[model samples]
Target chain A: MTISWMDPHTTSKESRSCIDCHTDPKALGLGAGSLVKIKGSWRLVPATSKSRDRRLNIPRLDGFVDISGKPLVLTSRKDLRPFDAAELKRILDVGQCLICHKDFDDKVMKNWNSLSPPKPCKFFLKTR
Target chain B: MKKRTTYLLVALVTIGLDTDSTASYYLGAKIIMGGNNSVVECNLAKVEVAGSNPVSRSRQFIKTGSHCCPFFVQENFYMHPRRRLLTLAILFFSLAFHSLFPCTAVPPCQAAAVDSPSKVSTTASGQIDMCLSCHDERPDRAHGRKVLGCFSCHLGNPLTGSAKLAHKGMVLNPGELYIVSKTCGQEGCHTDQVKRVKKSLMATNRGIISTLRYYWNESKDHDADLTVEKLLKSDLDTPAIDYYRKLCGTCHLWLKKHTLPGFLAEKGGGCTTCHFYKPGVGKDGKKTNHPMITKHIPMKNCIRCHNRSGRIGIAYKGIYEAEGYGTPFEDGDVSEGQLSDGRYIKRLEPDIHFKKGLICIDCHNQKEIMGDGNEKAHFEEQLEITCTTCHDGRQRLEKIFEEDIKRPKYPLLTNLVKKNGNFFLKGKKDQKLHPLHRFLDTACRHPVHERLACQACHSKWVPQCYGCHVVSDKSKDQLDKLSNKQTPGRWEEFRSFMRYEVPSLGIKKDYKTRQDKVVIIVPG
Candidate 1:
């Protein structure tokens, strides 16, 4: 799972893969920001804090898009991990990209000079 | 909620104490900076005037105070290098900040703004009006309400600050039938809908009129409108039209709104009859926000007027309301407050789909409810969405469809793909994994019954009210000379009516085909 966002539960788990956690609707990238299905039609909750704050920060989870340019919007408070501030900071503090994709620690150095944002999936999967 | 009032601080700087010099000048500047974006420096302490008097100097101020919501200074070129540069930079920054982040916009509980004559919020000044001064705590929902403003639906002058003057011509709710076409159904709004709704059977009472006329020997014609709109327009005496006004008109959405505290009088009209009407529950009315706007027009709203007439909406809930409609206090067998928004628990069993939590929208689409611009004389002419349209195809297959796309629940959702006469729902990827009755494809499905309308078998009940009599009496109210339609005091009333709720059962003949017919319907 991607750790660009500040999430604690994603870091605590020992296993982190691209497909596993990304599949869950609760994951930041999976849900269409602010939209929830209601009786087969799209009912917009304009009052939701995410929509009120304006643009949805959809992070680019796929390599085809740039992460910085497309942050998956943090629309609803439901997107936040159901934990207290203290607990969230603990999970967030210990997290880093190297925790899962550890072999690509060398790739971090290249992001500084790269013209565009790094695509983790393309960088690692293409090599494999 | 304790609201935080952001007060605008206006700093007026006037320079020049020394009055003995060689130039004609009277200079004073007013600068308004919101939040912390812009700052003004007024350091010119001394000046000399050659020729102009203090009275003549007033024109140079430019009179820019009108733009102030709280306060907005007009744009002017500054002679000083530092002042000019500072003013230019501040104007640019303030312009961007003013439009994007409205100074008045904040937490609804903590937002406040002075009624500005210039900048209303950040958009149009006269649009939001001074209504925000009092109801400023209420946040504007983003369904184009900011553009439309409070005056759009609620007829009132938002431009005025005074409570009395502002509400001079205000309508508590734009639900009245006579005014609906110009208000809620006004141009750029639901204009087309109001037009069709005026002509629809619900408005025209075509079904009741046509059926009664046919049964009563008034006419042998099958035209639904013959009983109401046709009679109202004809040169015939008041009895025919009054018959509708007393008995049939009560159920139609076009019925005039009355303020009586009873179950029926307080019922809504026009768009509100289906969308936003509800009776007051308690004396204080604290629990009920009467003019509630909701798109999910609850089933209860439909049953308000319908429960007594055809009872079709009530029948959808499987309620066969009692057969007596008499006594002023009690209208029907269903007690007051029993029909609610959340749930209507009843002994009468509803359709299976209703039990499965399928709402009316599952079958009826936009084109069905709101006409397709091409006006039709009747509602039966509009219904095209059906059951087999979704069930007949390869069905709700997961990931892959063996057949093509067929009848979609909503025909107006034209973006959806339909293949080889049928549309199949995709699985987990698109959330179209609706389970289908695969048994429909088997030989035991009875090919001879294939043409039957789905509701003929599926719908468990149809609410029908019986034994309705018309009452003609001179109305207590004085003459209504304005419209000159109804003579003063002369009108009809409906008080005693009987109802019978029964299960729906019928033999389908030539259903869904060229020779479609579902006759032999006992209204009850």
Candidate 2:
């Protein structure tokens, strides 16, 4: 009898703090990088100079896809995808706001999604 | 004297004696309806005539009971050939129109047999249940031989003496959804529950199939004609459908018990899938007499099939199935972190409910699991409980306590107890009283937090499979669990990467509530 097993996904219980998902580029499927603003545009500064895979010629295994949604792994499903450039920018822009506004009760953080809200962060306007 | 005779007939009807062979059932009804003033009583075990001023021997009829006389009762009656033929014609018409006038007060007559038992073969209702003669194993307290007997759940001809005749239409497992109406859904039994469970998502599997078919571009929308019940009937084959039949079909309630191989054989026996519990032998190696069939379902029952797919079952208990590298060999030996089904797992922090030892049924009530007789399309639509329902202390705590009161008791849900003029929900499994704290309004009253689902912030992590490649080989044959036959096409899936991390966030627009909520999204 041939004994085989299959379960592609499982989870641990240690939860992510606010900064782990919001600020970290690797956590958001953008690879290991530091987010910085250069000339009114957000640019990812690579943390490590890693070599590409010789066989597939794709990015390293740790990363799923780049900020532009160009897949590093072979994804056959149209529904299963990584964050696109616009989505990545939107998430990182919030990360900038979170740096100054640590607490959720902050007036600027409370009305972040509202239309005529307080703009406390100078970095948010640069991305917009 | 005539009034005494009328009372005996009324007592016979009230006891629900199936005296159709004695012809008293129809005669008693006819006499009661006609309001006959004349006293009439049959001779005990003999065909004797009764005159208009019949002797007050109606007490003897009551004393002799169901095994009384087989005489036709009429004014100046005798055992004549033409009179017997007329009685037979009346019997035929009564049988035809019996349901029109329902016997509201009468209990359903238990199946009975002739040959008087020398040893053991009689139910509590004084009926000869021939099933107990051969298969007389002691059942649980709730479904004792004296109470339900063997004939209640397992429908068969219990009146017959011959084994062949008795076993003619015997159902092996009455919990199977197709024949549940004849067994569990019997008039005075769980008729309403059976009706509701048939429409439940667990039996129908509407949401799972619809989402899969929609993702595969086979359907325009997620609400399509794809359900487990529909799939079992049709022989249609598509890429997504074929994959679903071979893989995902084992979890639903329609799957027959003992049909599949290995661990799968234990899954999906309708009501018994969740409710059946077989106790182990005594510590002294003595065999236990009974197996419990109860509403108090354990965590192991829910986790049997729920360990796969979403992996919510395992996740609740802090067990994570990890990659197969034997993971950081300790003490000069590979760690034995394998499941009985041959999967390697690592320990993680369990859910808050699991840490406190609350079982699945403590929060999830009958309505959420069995459904409310509505044909819902998804699990979210079927599920009624939320974090707010329990912890928020504002929404559904009172309703949850009321639902728990209805369950059968041996081991009661001690969680929902009133202590010192205060209602507190203790953990059913752990027996520890958990404090229900309302959401802290100091930090939670922000506008951004208003539209956020609890799981968006609180859920630790979700399992992520980046690229899952499923390859189906048409040359090989594989066993279909639903059909129980080996058909063409063997399928296998290989995942490129697996990771556990913070789930991606997405907007869920609830059209019914008119609320735009941010919820955690796990990519399929």
Candidate 3:
């Protein structure tokens, strides 16, 4: 119930925009997933899965489609992990993003802030 | 047939050109030996007399075309003797030689091979690419520095414009195991390296052979102890050879560089093991000549052979190409992972080093991977680098292994050490000294996990496919439904893969010793 999407008064237009939801660390599964699990009587269990996203609170890649029609994004759920310390520059930096994303394309995140709301792209599944 | 004709013509011209003293020469030996033992009446030179010579005789018809004849049999016969004596001597010589060296034809039961061109190049300079006659524009070769023409690697007649003649004795992929030595291990080139590669695990596939043989109990001897040369030369039993040829044969360095329908066309051979680029793609959206011999090797090249069995290179990158999946991830599938041309690849992961722009050669020394020319029983024994070798900068390893990192091993650790004494690696950006930094003082600096390999802790994932089902003879259709490739003889393998991207830790077992060793293992 913490996210805006969870709020009872959330609007349809906001849900449609990928940027409004995905770019947010909390909106994406980056935040601890579902604080409580029902063991017998709704006990609060921390979500400590072994996925890269779980160990470190992060999205590993910037979403961009490649030349031969291959996107660099992790397509499988098994590999969802926090971007390691090494991947920081590649994902966040302006020069590296432009490699595949191109200069100021329509899909470019306005300010392209990862922590901000991300644009709605099906490629970043569950990230939103 | 034409080669024989050409050689015959050459020998005739050579003998014909020398009109000095009388010389009885033996010809047509090559034609006879070329499996063309069909007897033919040969024309021996006539004795030119003064029209009234006392020993004048009719033309002597000599039967020939039986076996291979060396070019210099006329040397000893020039001593003496007149017309009939010389003719009699020459006839006697031909009969003796033909009887000794019989031209036995290949039996009809076995497939008949028409001819085999001599394995000789026209020139030592490695020039003359018949491929260049049509493929004139040399896009880019991996070994461009050598200035060698196409014929250097692809052994075919380069000067001849005719496609068939040019392609004569031409191998589609010189990188294939059968010819890697001749193609890559030429006089001045990768001779020593190719020698070692013939023995290298990647080429010989010693570990896989031993493991499968032991696992199946096919042979008690297993031929594991024999050197690669011995193993190749030794006549293996039918079941063992069948197992090797059908089930496990495709990955060996001898495997040809051709593409199966749903597989990458991995160029298999000595230098091309790491050098020859596969499935070459250009920006123009057209296929180009992918024959490259270069140091700029990508991880995918290693995966072509290493992919299914142990799955080392792909595991290093965290991308497991399980058998169920259609295509193993190429560099295009993982690293550049995407291009803005609205293209994307889904199934892949990069190792931590790869993510940090470190390639396979970054950590592994060339000589170490290629071997220092000494043959070892197991490839694992030859590995030089370890976790401590780079991160720890610790003491020398026991005398069990060699410890020397070649100069310019990689740009990261290439002699460019920092002032604090620890080796420094140049970062991808800003030329930052990404020191092979050891933080022992602050971190847990104990030997708790010293026995564990570097991959034990650092590896993000290890791919383990439970059932590797290879049926030796698909034609037989004798499938042991319960048994995988472990069955004594079967070829076509169809196994469902169970991928464990999560770090899979296991207690290492030494089959040779028949003991459970404490040595830990992941997907390295």
Judged by DockQ, which candidate is best?
2
For model 3, the stretches where C-alpha displacement exceeds 4 angstroms are A1-128, B1-146, B158-164, B219-223, B226-244, B259-261, B264-270, B278-290, B320-350, B394-422, B426-434, B439-444, B447-450, B466-518, B521-524
**How far does residue A54 in candidate 2 sit from its true spot (Å)?**
14
- How well is each residue in B341-393 modelled by candidate 3, as lDDT tens digits? 22222345555555665656555666567776765545545665544555554
Candidate 2 structure quality by residue, lDDT tens digits, B426-523: 77566677676666554445554576666655667566554455788999998887788899999887765555665555445543475666554443
What candidate 1 gets wrong by more than 4 Å, as runs, is A1-128, B1-128, B135-147, B175-177, B224-240, B256-261, B277-290, B323-346, B374-378, B395-434, B438-447, B459-512, B516-520
Q: After the best TM-score superposition of candidate 3, give how far the Cα of residue B49 lies from its true spot, in angstroms.
A: 48
Candidate 2 vs 3: which has more DockQ = 2
Worst 10 residues of 2 chain B by lDDT: B47-56
Worst 10 residues of 1 chain B by lDDT: B1-10
What is the TM-score of each predicted model, taking all chains together? 0.48, 0.72, 0.48
Native interface contact recovery, model 2 = 0.09
Per-candidate interface DockQ score: 0.01, 0.15, 0.02
Candidate 1 yields a Cα-based lDDT of 0.38
lDDT of each: 0.38, 0.59, 0.39
Q: Model 2 residue B425 lDDT?
A: 68
Query: Which TM-score values does chain B get in all models?
Result: 0.56, 0.74, 0.57
